[model samples]
Each structure stands twice: as structure tokens, then as C-alpha cells.
Target chain A: MDIFGVPIQALMGQLMLGIVNGSFYAVLSLGLAIIFGVLKIVNFAHGAFFMLGAFTAFLLGQHLGANYWVALVAAPIAVALFGMLFEWLFLRRLYGLDPIYGLLLTFSLVLVLEGGFRVAFGSSGQPYATPEALRGTINLGFMVLPIYRGFVILAAVLTCLVTWYVIERTSVGARLRAATERAELTQAFGINVPLLVTLTYGVGVGLAAFAGVLAAPIFHVNPSMGSSLVIIIFAVVVIGGLGSIMGAIVTGLGLGVVEGFTRVFYSEFSSTIVFLVMVLVLLIRPAGLFGREES
Target chain B: MHLRSLTLPLSIVAVLALLAIPFFPQWIYLVFVMKTLCFVLFACAFNLLLGHTGILSFGHAAFFGSGAYIAGHLVKNYGVPFELGILAGGLVAALLGAVIGALAIRRSGIYLAMITLAMSQLVYFFYLQAPFTGAEDGLQRVPRGTFLGVIDLRNDTALYYVVLGIVAVGLWVVWRTVNSPFGQVLRAIREHEPRAISLGYPVARYKILVFTLSAGLSGIAGALKAIIFQLAALYDVHWHTSGDVILMTLLGGMNTVFGPAVGAAIVAALNHYLDPFGAWVTVITGVVFMACVLAFRQGVVGELGRLLKLRRPSRPEQTADQPARGESQP
Candidate 1:
């Protein structure tokens, strides 16, 4: 009943944990890929927006008695609106400059957002309880799983799939892809590329906020939470190839599972496993597993 | 009216001001100068890659952090001399940089930056868990052994002067490299990699060499700080330190020799003075980042050079034909 000197039940539990973590990675990285495709700016502040989502959801629950469902739908919209406004106001100016300027701008936004939150809320995390409907554990033959964690996996997968479909199949998705390929040409053809860009950024961040609300129950609402995961997400994006949606989803989930297994085998390397994998991947395939060759 | 003509007097004034830091003899001045010198070296070393080579490495703190950790451990744990430990630190960081730079340089722009970042974070996590680093509590009370087996580095004046001399040498080395044939190639690679490659330049090799040099120098700075403060911790290797160096260099001016130094001094002084308002420091740094990127991408020294009609110490042809170029901008 034991695998690798650990109980099978414990092993399954870790696997479940891995899937849960992977779900968050999948959702976040998917958002990153989309944003990069449409906006062509690395939104370094995506992590901050994630934190904002969690904080906003927590605030609603604490002050307004808004339930988890309301927070779930409202959080993404709220963060999305803010992201759209930010895109329209600031990101519009950075179009022709080198990409580093855009990165620096977003990086600064992350600093301001994180520092502001830290100043208002102390460094210590504030816990959010699991919702009443999802507080209990369900037996899964080999192991027991928390309903909230299971819900996260299902929701994250669903969101990624829907996003992929919308981007890869729908007519609007065609416009998005066409714009990504030839923004000027697309603009010449009478499509509102600029407005599309703003809307795309909103969708990308809405995805992150949705994940953030999901994370609020699992991890405490801490200012540092989003920043910590963001670097790892970047690694996932690189390994999968930037702007590669399928690559992001696969790499994100795969790394999460690898992290879990590392925990079960040698916990010391848990924190470093993702990055180590990234180094190996970059050494072997500089363009990433899914990225096209540099023209 | 070319500012290049004033390099001699500017150098003299700068050296004199640095020399005056330790002569004041106040404990505050020593600590401030010591810390500032290390950061100045750190920022300049980083700028070597970012500004000159056009490789934006986000994981540079790996060298800085590892440099401090190795030097502190050698001196504190193995009873090695301080000078030896510091050299060892630079060597270790250089080795790490070579390995990281090899893989990292294969990808440019954000990918390159992220690779360095992730690798450094791996190193940071390694340090945090490694017993020698003392975990979350951090390694403390490291001994400041004699410098080169003779001079007592424990004295505040000695340590201050030593740091100042090394940092000055480091800055001069950066300035020289930027103007050298090797540095010219780096700038070529930065501005246009494809052209450089087409010109029969071993672009990758030059990039890696510069990357190693920058890493080693950054390590030396970290080692010097560790010995001076007698501590090494999670903060030294954090991603934030990497960002801090970037902020420092950009705030002072990217693509300029003396800019990172000024940037480092300003940032270090801000941290020192605003110690009580810890969170505000980060917020203010963020604001500065936005301002610099938005309005003043040329940086302070770069802007000053433009205003003063100074030519960057670039290739000879550019400097000779500067007047035509100046008219194009104005």
C-alpha cells in the first residue's frame, strides 16, 4: 500500500495537490500567452493584478458580505476593468519603443501595486475560509480529496479550454490572430485593433483574477503570493514558448506535477525543480518546446 | 565644446571625492561609503551586460548573492583570509555566470532575462535551504580576517579605503571594456545581432565573455559587502536585488560608464535615509522606474551628455562625425 516509502494515500494526496497547483499555473500562463499575443507587452504586473484579484475578493467577502460566487464573477471583472483602463492610459504610449520599455513600465506597476498593498495590509497573510458548499472532503477510493481543490482543477481546465477555443476557432479569435500577425494591415482593413488590444488585455487579466479568486481559499490573501508564483509562471511560459497557448497549458500543468513528485521524493529541491527544468530546457531548445524558430 | 575634453578634470574630481570619504573618519561615512562602493560596483557590473551588450539579465543577483555566500562561508567557516575569500567569491560567481550565460544568451530579450531570473531563483532557493546559509535566519557574525595576510581589514578606515580602491578599479575596468575592441563588438551585438553575426564576429562568444566578466565583478561587490557587514542573507540573492541593480543603472543612465555608479549611490543613499519607511522605498523606486522609462530613457548621465554636447566613447568614426549626428537630434 506504499509507494516510494510513502503511503499510497499520501501519494495520491500529493498528486491531487500537484494537479491543483498545476491548474493555477495553467490558468495564469494561459493568460500570459494571450496577453503577449495581443498586446505584445510582457505584463510584469500580471502578478500584481492576481494579488489585487485575491485582495478584492477578500475585501468583498469581509466587508460587503459578498459570497464566494459573487467574488468569483466580480473579481475578474473588476481587475479586468482596471487592466483595460491601464492599457488604454499607459500601454498605448509604449507602442513603438523597444520592448524593454514596456517591460520596465509593467515591472514598475508591479512594484507600486505590491508595495501599496504591503503598506496597507501588514506582511502577514490573512486567511480566507473555504466556502460552506466546498468545505468537506470526498473519498476517492485510494484517497480523500478536498472539494474546493477539485473544483479549482475543473474550473481551471474549463477556463483554459474555453479560452483556447475562443482564440483558435471563433471569428473574433480570427481577428485577434490576424491582428497579432499584422496589426497595421489589420488596422488598415477597418478592424479596431486598438480597442481589440484593450479588450484582449482585459480578458487576459480577467483570467488571472479568476485564478486569484480560486487561490484565495487555498492560499492566504498575502501581498507576496502572486509575485512568488509569477517567476515560476514565466519559466513555464519560456519552456512552452511565449505566446504558445497549448504550450503554456501543458508546461504549466507538467511543471506543477513535477514539483509535486519532487516533494514526495526529495523535498529540498521542491522550490527549485521548476527553474532547474527551465535551465535544462533552454540549454537543449532555446526556442522552447512549442515556439517557432526565430526568423 | 565636446564633453570628452573634460574627462581628465572630471576624473580628477571624482577620484578626489572618493578619496575624501574615508578621511572624514566618521563611522556613518565609512558604512555609507562601503555600502555605496559595493552597490556601485554591482550596478556597473550589471550595466556592462545590460547597457553595453544589450542582454537584459534578470537573474544577476545569483552572482551577487553567490559571491557573498561563498566569501562569507570561506572566511567564516574555513578560516581563509579575507582577500582570498573575496577572490574566491568572484571566481565562483564567474563560473556560475559562465554556465548561466552560455544557456541564457541563446535567447535574447525577455526570454533571456527570464532564464537568468529563474536560474538565479534556483540558486537563491539553494542558498536558503543549504545549511551554510543558515536558512531563513541567514548567516551572521562572519569574521573579517586580515587582508592579504597583513593589513587589518577589521579597522573601519582600512575596510573603507580597500572597498573604495577595488570599486574604483572595477569602474575603470568597465569604462575601458566599453571603449575597447571587445566592448565595441558587444555594442554591435546589442544594437543589431544579425549584422554582427554576418560580419564574421563570434557574437555568442563575445556575449558570454562579457557576461562572465559582469558576473565576476558583481560577485566581488557582494563579497566585499558581506565581509564589511559580516553577514549574508536571503536578501542578497533575492530577485528584488536583481531589480534593484536594474533600477539603479537605469535611474543613473543606461549605456553610460559612470551612470550606474551615480544611480547606485542615489539608491543606496535612499535606502539608508529611508530605512524607517521600508515599503515606501520600494514604491518610490517603482515610481522612479516608471519616470525613467517614460520620460528619460537616456538616463541622467545620458541626458546630461546630450545637453552638454558630449559624445559617447563609441567607435572612432561616430565620434569624428559627431557634429552631423548632433544636428540630426537637435
Candidate 2:
């Protein structure tokens, strides 16, 4: 009934929580991996965009009296458009230069967004209630799972699968891959590579915002929330390897579960275990689990 | 218009300004200058890797914060002399840097930065949970401790001079490292790692050495900060501090010797003046970051050098042939 002196029920509960956390990690890092692949710049503002999504949802609910479903549908689209504007205006200029500048530019956006949110709202977190329909818990025989948490997992998985399918299967996806491999050559083939790049950034940021909406009800919606999570997601990106979409999802979920197990055994180290995994992965397989070794 | 011609005059002016600080109108200004000096050293150490070596380690605060913790514990609890405490902090940070750099140097560019950031997060978690760090409260009321056997650092004037002296020595080390043949090898590695390897240089080894040295020097700065404030708090090790150092380096002209120090002063002054504005400081700082990256990529000192038609002090040929080469808005 117990695994290592902890009860099965408790273990199952933690596992459920871990999967929920993993879902967010998957969605967020998937966005990161996609952005890196096409744009060739790590979007440091990805986390801030995630926070913006949550805030957008909150603001809509407050001012527009929008429901959960409505906010979810609208927030990402709005944030994505903003992201596209950012890409077209600023990020476009940094291409062909050192990638560090891209990172630096996006990082500044983080400061602005987080600071702006903090000033407009207080530094403390704002609470978002779970939707009316998904307020109750379901019994999984072994453990009781919150309906909202289950919904979150389902929604996140669906989003990831759809994104993966679009990027890896469709003809549009072919153009994307071609552009990523050889931008100039792809353009020579008569594609609007610049537009495609801008769209990719928008989609990537939109994905982050989508994850943010999902997280708003579960975690406190606050300015500093994404800053901390972004670092862990960076660990996830590293462990999974950069630019690998499948790798980002799998590693994120696996690390979440691993972190959950660590909590059961060594609760103090739950926050640090992912980083430890990163260090180990770097030692054994420097290219990352899913990444190709750079020339 | 040669930068070398201005170096002597600039150095003399800077020294005079530093010495005159103690005689400033207000006593509170000393605290500001001391803090700025600490950041100046921290930013310079950071530049050794970023500006000179072309390696971006985003998690640099791990070494800095650990150094503070180590030095603070030694001085406050173990009764070690301040000198030994500071050295111990630097050595420990160097060890940490070696371990991190050895793993991180395996990957180049963006990946390297992520690895360092992740490792520093791990370090941050440790400090957050560790008993010795006093959790969030930090190691407070740490004794200033006497310098040597008798200098009496308890006096604010005495402590300021000691801080200034140590920071000067630290800056000299950075200068020596950059001007030495070893520094040339670092530049070669930075410009092109593959070429450096083809030329039979141990590229990874050199990267690790610079990383270790940078971390050690940063540790000295952090240790000195702990002594000056008489406390070792969590923010010193936070990623925000790491980001601040990067900003200072970039805004001051990473390639120039004294650019980061000037950048540090500007940032410190901003923080001091903007203390009344609450969250606006973060917004302003962010604006500054954007402005620097977008328009002023060459930084304050680098821009000055360009305006005067003075060749870049470190490498005149690179500047003349390709102005703002990597940083140009292409």
C-alpha cells in the first residue's frame, strides 16, 4: 500500500499534481523550442508573454465580464498579435548578428512587462477562481483528482499534439522546416520567409500565453510568477535539448514526475532536482537528449 | 585620437575622484560609492568572460552569492580574518566556476548560457534552503572585522579605503589578464573557436581558465560587499544580480577596460536617484537595456572612442575594419 513508507494515495496525488505541472512545462518549453528552431534566437520574453496571457485573462474577466472559456480563446490571439508586432518592429533588426543580442533584447521586454504589471497591479498575486463547471473533484479509485486539473492536462496535451502535428506534418510545416534549414534558399524558392519568421514568433509567444491562461486558476497570477518558472523551463529545455519539439514535451513531463518523486522522498530538493539532472545530462551527453551536436 | 593617450589622464582623474569621495558633503554618499565599486569589480569580472572571451554564462550570480555566504560565514562564525575570509570566498568560487565551466564549455553560445543559468538556479535553491545562509533572513549583523592585525576597519573611512584598494587590485588583475599573451589566446578563441582549435590551441581549457578567473574575481567583489554591508542576503546570489552585471558590462562597452566601471556608476546612481519611484526603477532599467541593445550597441566608452576617432584600445584593427561588426543592426 505504501511505496518507501509513503502511502499509495499520497503518491498518486503527487503524481497527478506533477502531471499538471508537467503539462505547463510541456506547453511552455514547446513554445520555446519552436521559437528557437525557426527564429534562431532564444525568446527570453517567452515567460513574460506567458504572464501577459494570464493577466489578459484576468483583465477580461474583470473589465469585460468574460467567462473562462472566452478569456482562454481571446487572450492568446491578442498576445500573439502583440508578439508579432514586437518581432516585426524590433527582433527583425537583430538577425545575422550575435544571438546574444536577441537574448538581451527579449530580456528587456521581460523587465518592462513584469514591472508594468507590478505597478498596475500590486506586487502580490491576484487570485483566479476555477470555472463553475470544473470546480469539483473526480475519484480515480486510488486518488481524488480535481476536475480543473484534469481539464488542464487534457487541454495542454491537445494543444501540444495539434502544434506538433502542424509543425511536423502539414505542407505549411514543410515550408517552415525549409526556412529553418536555409532561409535564403527558401526565399529563392519564392516563399515569404520574413512573414513566416514573424508568424512563427507570434505562434511561439501565443503558445506561452495559452499556457499562462491554463495556469492562472491553479497558480497565483502575479508578475514574478513566470520569471521563476522560466528558469526551470530553461532547465527543461537544456535537459531535453534545444530546438527539439518532441524532446521538450517528453523531458518536461518526465522532469515533473521526477520532481514529484523527489518531493515524496527529499522534499527539500524538489526545486533543485531538474538542475541536477541538467548538470548530469551535460556531463554525459553534451548535445542534449534530443539535440544534434553542433559543428 | 589614440585611446592610449587618454589612459594616463583618465586614470589620474578616476583616482582623484575616488580619493575625494570620503570628503564628500554627505556621509551617506560613501555607502553609495562603496556599493558602486563592488558592482564595478563584479561587472569587470563578468566582462572578462563576456567581452574578452565571448562566452555568456547567464548564471554567474552563483559564484558571487556563494562567495558572500562563504566569506560571511568565515568572518562571522569561524572568526577568520577578513583577508582570509575574502580569499577563501574567491577560492571557493573559483572551484565552483571550474565545475560549472567544465560542464558548460561542452556546449557553445546560447546553450552554454542556459546551462550556467540552470546551475545558478540550483545554487540559489541551496542557499534558500541551507541553514547556514539563514534562509531568507540572511547572515545579518556580521562583524566588520579588523583588517590585517590592526587597521580597524570599524571606521567607515578606513573600510572605504580598504574597499577601494582591494577593488583597484582586482581591476589590475583583469587588465593584466586581458593584456597578457594568455589574453590574446582568449581573444583568438572568442573570435573563432574552430580556428583556434585548428591552430592547436586547447580551446576548452582556455575557456575554463577564464571562467574560473572571472568567477574568482566576482567572488572577491561579493565578499567585499558582504563586509561593507555587514550582511549576506539572498539577492546577491539571485539571477537579477547576474542580469544587472551583464547590463553594466554591455552598457559600459564590454570591450573597453574601464567601461563597465563607468556603467556601474551610472546604474548605481540611477538606483540611488530612482529609489523614490518604487517600481518605476525596473521600468526605467528595462528601457535603458532596450536603448543600449537597439541603438547604443557599442556602449558609452566604445561610442566615445568612435566619436574621437580613437582606435579601440584592445584591438584597433578589428574596430577599424568592421565597425560594430557583431553588434551592428543588420
Candidate 3:
């Protein structure tokens, strides 16, 4: 049962873990791509929103006695509403300005949000327990997988496909594309471009929150969690090509698997490997793997 | 209508205040000033890429931290002279800058920022895993070697003066670069890359040049801090260090030559006073960030320069290359 000096089971286990992690990466990067594509703004607070989603779930569970099931549905919705509200209140003003302003503004929100949480919860991280129903393990011939992880992978892949379908295949996606490409023209065609932009942003934020909720059981619910992962996600965005949907999904999953394998073989270099890949990608394709060169 | 300019006297007073810092009776406050001065150099280095070249680098701390690590490892382990160690630190950072700058400068705006951040985080991970870095404990009890093998930097006062000298020279170099033709071209490139190219400027070369210089100078700052404190820690190279430098430059003013130093001083002071609040400093810094972006985009010195220009109409775009990095100055 040995495969290249590592056990077959170990290899399979790592691969499964990698896919689960990849699913999270795929979902997160999709949200980033959507925001950057339509809004022309890099939502730096995406990670913060992710953390907030987890925290929102945490808070709901604690205060309102909502279970994990309730949180799984409500957290992303709550975050989406918050995201839409912010888009209306603040991000709306930054539309015509340099995208850097949007970056700075959202960057500040990260600080504020993380700082607030740190003050309230302290930085040590609170854990959410796995629900009793999904607490078992599934054994394949090569490996034994945690049921929760399998579910996560399945959920995440489905979400990614659905998101891609909606954005790339649906009429609403067409409208969304048209609005971003030519807002005034879309407006002339009787489309609510402004409202569409807001909705797109909400959906984007909701995706990040959904990822966050999924992560709550896997990782500790901590203030620094979002900030930490966000940097890696940024790398994923860069490697995949900014605003490229499929690029984001593919690169996220690929890098996550690469990272997971790196963890198994040469564990010490796991984190740095993604960045090295980014550096290599940039050197080879300055426009990114899927990004078109801007005029 | 005929008010005499007070710039000369103001500068002299500021210089005098700086010169008088070590003379202060309280060692704690003087240490604080020492730390502030180091960050001043670091922030100014960062601002060279940011304000002058119009690059929003989120990972300049890699250079700074690398410099510290290199210097600390050399001096603490190999017993290299502090002067040579410092030079070595800057050289290493410069080399790193050349590589990172070359890659990062290829992309513009947000992409460039993210690239720098990723690379720096990579560096952090390297340090975390690298045994020589002394990761958890860092390179501790680094020896304070002599300057030129003559001046003993072991004493706090001697170290302070040396640091001040290094910072003075560093600031002067940045100031010189900012007002130089190269600096102007960088500003031009920052303001508008397409136009700069149309004008036959090798925009990327200029960016890499400034990026390298800034990174080298930032490395020197980190090296100096390691020397003064006799410690080189992981915290020195963290993204927070990069953010701190950015915060300093933003708060002080992005457009002005003296802005980052001024911003660094203010932030360091505030950090000292607000030390009891623990993480509130980050929150406050974020508040300042929002405030500056929203209403006070010009920053403190930018505002001051505007006030000084009260006799003339404000050139809003001239003071900052806002709305985007390296997009349009003309």
C-alpha cells in the first residue's frame, strides 16, 4: 500500500483534504472575481466579510440559540444584507473614483472589523462544534474521509458550478454583464444598472460569507482568520487572472491541491509555494493565466 | 500680502529638536524617539515607491525584515561588524527589491499591490520555516558591533546618534531622489504610464530603480533597529510592518517629501500614548485611513501645502496621484 515512499492511504487522505480546501479557495476566489469583474473594485473587505459570516453564525448560535443548521442558512444572508447596505451607503460614492480609493476604503473596513472582533472576543479563537448528524467518517478503499469534509467539498463544488452557471449562462448574468460593460447604455435599455451593481456586490459578499460559514467548523472562528486567508486568496486571484471566473475556480483548486501535497511531502514549504507559483506565473504571463491584456 | 516665508527657520527648529532627542533625561522617551526615527526611515523608503513612483506596494516589509534578519544573523552568529552588517543588509534587500520590483512593476494598480503583498508574505513564511531565523524566538541578543570598527555602538547614546545619522542620510537621499529629474520622471510615470511611455520614458526601468532604492533604504532602517535593540524578530517583517509604513505615509501625506517621517512621528507618538488600548491602535488607524480617504485625501502636509498656496488656486490633482496609482499626473 506504499506509493512513492508515502502510504496510499496517506496520499489519498491528503488529496481529499486538498480538494476540500480547494473547494473553499474556489468559492472565495469566485466572489473576488465577481466583484472585480462587475464592480471594477477589488473588495479588500471580502476576507473581513468572510470572518463576519463566521462570527455572525457564532453570534446567532450563542445569543439566539440558533443551531448550526440555522446559521448555515442565515449567516450568508445576513452578510449579504450588510454588504448591500454598505454598497448603498459608502461604496456607492466610490464608483467613479480610482479603484485604489475603493481598495483603501475596504482595507480600512478590514481593520475596523477585525479590531472590533478582537476587542469583543479576544484573539484566541472560538470553535463551533460539528453537528451530531454529520459527525461520522466515510471510508473509501484507499482512505477514510470525514463526512463533514466530504459534504463541504460537495457543497462547495455545487456552489461554484451554480455560480458559474448563473453568471455565465443565465439572462440575469447577461444583464449583469451588460450593465458592468456599459452602464449608461444598459440604463438606456431600461435596466437598473445601479441596482444590478448593488445586487452583484451582495451576491459576491454572500459567497464569501457562505465560505466563511463552511470554514467555521473546520477552522477556529477568530478575528485574524479572514485577514490571514485573504492574503492567500489575493495570490489566488492574481494567479488565476483578475476578473476571470473559470480562471479563479481552476487556479484556486489547483493551488489548494498543490498546497496540500506540498504539506504532505515537503510540509515546511507549503505556504511559500503558492507565492512562488504566483511569482512564476507573473514572470511567464504578466497578464495572468486567463486575464486579457488591458489597453 | 507680503508675509515672509518661515520655511528655513521651521526646518532649523525641527533639526534642532531632532538633535536634542538623546539629550532628553528620560531614556524611555528617547528610546521611543529612536524607534520612531527608525520607522521614519522605513516609511520614507516605502514612500519613495508609493508617493514618488506611484506604486502601491503592500509588502515593503519584506525588504526591511530581510535586512534585519540578514544583519542579525551575520552580526550575532558570524560576528560581522555592524557597519558591514548594515551595508550587507541593504545590499541583500536591494537584490531582493530588484527581483520583486522587476516582477511587481510588470503589473499596474491593484495587481501590483497584491503581488508585492504575496511576495512579502512568502518571505514571512520563509522566515517562519527557516531555522536560521530563530522563528519563534527570533535572532535574539544580537551583538551591537562597532561602527567602522571604531565608534562603539554598544552605548545607547552612541547608537542613537548613529541611527540619527543614518536616518538623516537616508532622508536626505530620499529628498534628493524626490526632487531629482529621475524622481520627476517617476512622478510622471506614476501620474500616467501611457503618457510617460508616449514621451519615450522607459517607465518600468524607472519604477524598478525607485523600488530597489526604496527597498534598500528600508532594509537599512530594519538593520539599524536590529543593531540598536540587539534583536531581530519576526514581527519586524510582518505585513503589519508594511501596513504601519503605509499608515505613516498616508497620515503624513503621500505627495510631500517630508510626509512619511512626519506621519511616522505622529503615529509612533500616538502608539506610545495609546499603548494601553492594546488592539485599539489598529482600529484608530483604520478610522484615520477612512477619514483620509473620504475627506482628507490630501493628508497633513498636503493640506499644509494647500494652505501655504492660499494665494493661488488649489491644484487638487497635482498634490496626489489619487484615484489610481501611476495613472495620471498631467
Candidate 4:
């Protein structure tokens, strides 16, 4: 029952926890990659939208008596709509300028969202109850896993696959790819590249909201939660290669597991392991693990 | 046309006006001015990288906070002179800058920003876990120790003058650096990196050097702040501080030499006045950020410079580079 002088159950538990975290990373980074690909703007407000998703769910539950399932379906849609509006009104002007302006604009949005939420709800975290059906524990041969966590892993993986499917297989996805590659040409071909770009931004942030709702029960729902998570996701994107969709998903999951194991062995470094990995990756491969060199 | 001839007298008047701040107790608080001076130095140093070198480093808080923590730890525990502690802080931060800068400059634009941010997060985690930093409570009640073994800094008036002098010297260094021949090369690199590289300039080395100088100056600001407040806290190292510095530089006009100083004062004043609003301060700051990015990219000073026709119409870009760079002769 011991592996390398540590309990097998403890390792297994960390592994499961890591996988759940990986799922969130995978989903979040996928969104980042999508936005960066199509808009050529780094959506700094991605994390803000994530927080918005959780807050929307929390408020819906409180005011409208919406259930967990209702929130899971509605929060992302609402956030995506909000994101599309942001794209239409503000983010559109930033296109073709230095991407840093986009980052600064979104960073400002983060301040607004996080600060506003802190005002409405104190900085202290508010908890959301795990759904009744997924409240129990599951026993595996090596470890006992919380049913909610298992559900999280399952749900997150399914979300990633469906997102991948939509982006990779659909005709809409082909148009998106075409726009990302040659926006001017795509427009010449009668594709509304502008609308596609806006929708892509919406979809990207919607994915972040999806991860946020998924995280609500596992982590305390708080204003500042997504701020830090988004930074880590930025690292994940960097390590995986910016704008590389497959790279984002794979590196996110891999780094999460690496972080989980680091906790088991060198617990003090748990918070910093991903960043350290990023530093190492940059040193070895400046273009990132999956990114192509820019001309 | 004679505006450039007035630069010397204007600067002297400004300094003398600053010297008079300690005397005016009712109108302007000494502590507020001291804090603003710290940010002025900090923001100006940040612009060395941002405005001059065209590198957007998101991890500047690392240098600032580390400087604070290092100086605080040395002065409190080891009983080092305040000057030595400050120097040590700058040296350590510069060293950190060199390492971080070398790694970061390999990538440009957004990747560079993300790398610095991640590294700073790593530093943040270190401070959070390190025993010396006191985590949330921070390194508190640090002594304001003597300056060069004289000048009792425990007195607010004495400390204010010292802070003012140090900030003046710091700003002068920034001004000198920006106007130096080295600075022209930096501008050249910022304007076009590939061209600079092809022109035989060691682009990466220049970048790392500028990053080091900026970090070192920023470290001095952070260390002075710790000495002034007699505390080094977590917020100094937080990413929000990084964001705050960026806002200050951008809003003040990164291209203008005196812009960040003006920007820092304005932002510090905003924070001072908005403290009572609780979280609305952040909302307002964000609104300002949006406005600045969208409508005021030229910034307050930049717009003013434009309106004043600070430089010849033939050299539009140089207008912001140095408003007083020997262009006064008719």
C-alpha cells in the first residue's frame, strides 16, 4: 500500500485532485488559445468572466431560486452574451493595434469585476452546495474519491471534447480557422470575419465561465479566485504555446498533474511549481513547447 | 518659442516648491507627498523599460517588493545602515532583473508579459511562505534608521526632505538615462528592433541592461517607501501593484520624460481621495483605464505637449521623446 515510502492512497488522492485541476486548466487555456488565435488579442478579462460565471450562478440561486443544473446551463450562456457585447462595443476598436492594449483594457475589466464583486459581497468566499445527486463518495481499488470530484473530471473532459469537436470538425470551425489565418481573405470570400471574431471571443470566454461554474462547488466562490487562476492559466498557455489549441489542452492537464505530485513531495512548492516549469520550458524552448517561432 | 529656455528656472521652482511642502502642514500632508514621491520614482523607472525600451514587464512588483523585503530584513535583523540596506535592495533587484530580463527578452510582446507575471507569482509565493516576510502581516515596524549615520529619520520632517532629495536624484537619473546617447539607441531599438539588430546593435543586451537599470531604480523607490512608512508589506509584491504601476505609466504618457511622475502623483492622489469609497475606487480606476486606452492613448502630458507644439512639426515622434532636448535655439 506504499509507493516510494508514501501511502498509495495519498498519491492516488493527489492524482485525482490533480486531474480535476487539469480539467479546469484544459478548459480555461482552450478558451485563451481560441481568443488569441482569432482576435489576435489576449483576453485579460478571461478570468473576470470566469468569476462572473460563478457570481451569476450564485446570484441566480439566491434571487431567482435557480438550481445547480439551471446555473450550469445558463451561467455560461449569459457570460458568453456579455462577452459578445464587450467585444462589439469596446474590444473591437483594439483590433490591429498592439495586443498589449487589449490586455490593459481587459485588466481594467478585471479590476471592475473583482472590485465590484468585493463591494457587493465581502472578499470572503461564498460557498455553493454540491448538487444532491453527486454528494456521495466513490470507492476505487486504491483510493476513495469524492463523487463530486469524479463528476467534475467527467464533466470537464466531456466539455473539452465537445469544444474540440466544435472547433475542429464543424463548418463554422473551418470559417473560424480561415478567419484566424487570413481575415481579409475570409472577408473577400464573403465570410463575415468581424462577426466570427466577435463570436469567437464570446465562445472563448464562455468556456472560461463553464470552468468557473464547474469550480464553484470545489473551491469557495470568491471575487479574487479567478484572478490568480487566470494567471496560472496564462502560464499554462505560455508553456503549451500561445494560440495552439491542442498545446493548451495537453499542457494544462500535464502541468496540473505535475503540480499535484509536487504537492505530495515538496508541498511548499505546490503554488509555484507551474511557474517554475514555465521558466524551465522557456529556457529550453523559447518558442514554447508547441508554439512556432514568429517571423 | 522661449518655453524651452524656461526649463531650468521651472525645475528649480518645482524643487523649491517641493522643499516648501513640509512647511505647509494644513494644505498638503507630508506623508502623502512622500508616498507620491515614491511612486513617482517607481513609475519613472518603469517607463524606462516600457516607454524607452518598449518592453512591457508585468512582474515589476517582484523588483519593488523584493527591494522592500530585502532592505527591511537587512536593516532590521542585520543592523545595516539605511543607505547600505537601500543599495543592497537595488543590487539584489537588479540581479533579479538581469536574470528575469534575460529569460524574458527571448520572447517579445505578450509572451514576455506572461513570463514576467509568472516569475513574479513565483516570487510572491516565496514571500508568502518565507518566514521573514511575516506573510499577511508583512515585515512591520521597520526602523527608519539614520541616513549616513546622521539625520534622524524618525522625525517625519527630516525623513520627508530625505525622501524628496532621494526622489529628485532618482528622477534626475531617469531623465539623464532617457536623454543619454544610450537612450537614443534604446529609442531606436524600441522604434524597430530588427532594424536596430541589423544596424549592429546588440538588441538583447540593450534590453536586459535597460531592464536592469529600471528594476534597480524601482527597487530604490520600494526601499525608500519601506523606510518612509517603516513597513514592507505583501501588497508591495502583489500583481495588483504591478498593474497599478502600468496604469500610472500609461496614464501619465510613457513617451514623455516627466509624464510618469505626473501620472504617479495623480494616481496616488486618486487612491488617497478614493480610500473612503471602499471598492468603488477599483471600479473608477477601471473606468479610467478604459478611457485612457480608448480615447487618451496620447495621455495627459502627451496631449498637452502636442497642443503646445513642444517640438518642430518635422519631428513628430521626437516631440514626446524629449521636450527639452536642446530644441530651444531659434
Q: Pick the candidate with the highest lDDT.
A: 2
List lDDT for all candidates, in order.
0.86, 0.89, 0.85, 0.88
Off by over 4 Å in 4: B1-9, B310-330
Which candidate leads in TM-score?
2
Candidate 2: lDDT of A226? 93
Among incorrect, acceptable, medium and high, the docking class of model 2 is: high
DockQ of each: 0.79, 0.85, 0.79, 0.85
Clashes of each: 0, 0, 5, 0
CA deviation > 4 Å runs, candidate 1: B25-28, B310-330
RMSD for each of the candidates? 3.0, 2.6, 2.9, 2.5
DockQ for candidate 4? 0.85
**Higher-scoring candidate on DockQ, 1 or 4:** 4
Candidate 2: residue B57 lDDT (0-100): 87
The reply for model 3, stretches above 4 Å from the true place, is: B1-4, B311-330
Looking at model 1 chain A, report the run of 10 residues with the lowest lDDT sum. Answer: A286-295
For model 1 the local lDDT of residue B14 reads 83
Model 1 quality (TM-score): 0.96
Report lDDT (Cα) of residue A292, candidate 3: 82
TM-scores of the candidates are: 0.96, 0.97, 0.95, 0.96
Candidate 1 lDDT, A25-56, residue by residue in tens:
99999999899887777778888888999999
lDDT of 3 by residue, B24-140 (tens): 756457677888999999988898887887789999889999999999999999999888999999999999999999999878888988899999999898888888998879989
> Candidate 1 chain B, which ten residues in sequence have the lowest lDDT sum?
B321-330
